[model samples]
Target chain A: MEGDIASIGAGLAAIGSGIAAIGVGNVAGNYLAGALRNPSAAASQTATLFIGLAFAEALGIFSFLVALLLKFA
Target chain B: MATDTHETVVSACLDSHGGAIGMPQLCGEWIPHQIFWLLVALAATFFVMSRIALPRIAAVLAERSGTITNDLAAAEELKNKAAEAEAAYDKALVDARAQAQQIVAEAKAEIQAELDVELAKADAQIAEKAAESEKAIAEIRDGAVKSVTDVAKATTKELVAAMGGTADAKTITAAVTARMKG
Candidate 1:
């Protein structure tokens, strides 16, 4: 039971990564909906959309890092 | 509350354990390998994205913009054409109106000329009738004067004869004529 705590922590971190994925999906979905509506305006906002995607993906990466930390350090 | 205490205990244990964990990623021998692979993967991704995918995306965007601009230009041309057509239509309407007015004026002038001719003919007929009436009146006056002279002459002869005086026709005519003249 004592040794299993690390694996449980890693599993929770993996769940957090999954939650981050939902956040990333939210950002990407909204961007696509808006982009498809006004393709001309989409070009100007593409950088902003990508920045939002990176921010959400960074959270997932942080979760992955935490999982790695629990497993290895 | 119980979970929070357990999390703190695990955190303290992790702090004490340092790098001594059970995962292969923490092993010293794999560090170089992981770094090398990470670099390779990053380089490949950057090269592909920048050199291939991004350029294709840029081309599609440029084509879309070109299509939009060309369509807008065509719309502008059509709009100008519509305006020109409308102007021509208005000009034609004005010309038609002017032509109609000109035709009406010509008809009026023609009608006026006909009216003037008719009026002149009527005036001529009226003048002829007036002259005929004057001639007729003069004839009637001459006839009435002759009748009156004959009656006066007959009356004078009767009166002279009744008084036992001889009446000469020549003398009576002369006297009556002189009296009338005087």
Candidate 2:
């Protein structure tokens, strides 16, 4: 209660980081399901799976960066 | 320290309590230092990856692909060789079978010719034996006829003698022959 409105905005941005975690989990879970369905095709698609994981994690990192910026800057 | 009024004015970025008056990260004075360090880190990463890591990865990938291609080619060559060997084996088998058949046919023909020669020789021997037997049978038949005529003459002579007739040998023979003719 002693902090400014930017602290509240930082808390909301941290929520965005948590929401981004859901997106990353969805990407990984879908990839695992597809991999289990056709194991033979899974080896060829590992690069694509990694690229999806990086993209999803990068969004979460951006949300975390926004939260940090809101807190400090 | 109380005589330096310029030091108090220059330290406006900090509060009286030694805390930052505003966010230190957004200060203009630190921007150049942050950018310089950022560029240094990026250049170092680029140098390590380009000069060392990327080249090694590329070499490994190239070598692996080359080895795979060579192995595939070798397998293909071996397959062709196996096929060729099988064809040669099949051809040799066929040739051997044909040779065996020809040998069997030649042996059969030789055996048949030898059998025919033996059969002809046996047939000739049989014919010569038959001719000799026929000649012997004709001679025996002639002797039997002479014997029967002689026996009839003797029997008639004895019968005449018993009846007390004094007949001559020539007349008796003539009468026996005449009776035999009847």
lDDT of 1 at B119: 100
**Regions of model 1 farther than 4 Å from truth:** A1-73, B5-8, B13-68, B151-182
Task: Count clashing residue pairs per candidate.
Answer: 0, 0
lDDT per residue for candidate 1 within B1-182, as digits (tens), equals 33443434343223333423355556666688899999999999999999999999999999999999999999999999999999999999999999999999999999999999999999999999999999999999999999988988888889888999996999989988887778
Q: Report the C-alpha lDDT of model 2 over A2-73, residue by residue, as the tens digit.
A: 998888888888887788889889988998999999999999998998899898888888877887777876
lDDT tens per residue, model 2, B1-182: 44244335345455554455457676677778899999999999999999999999999999999999999999999999999999999999999999999999999999999999999999999999999999999999889877877898888889888998878889878987787778
Among all candidates shown, the one with the greatest TM-score: 2
Clashing pairs in 1: none
Error of 1 at A17 (Å): 36
lDDT of each: 0.86, 0.86
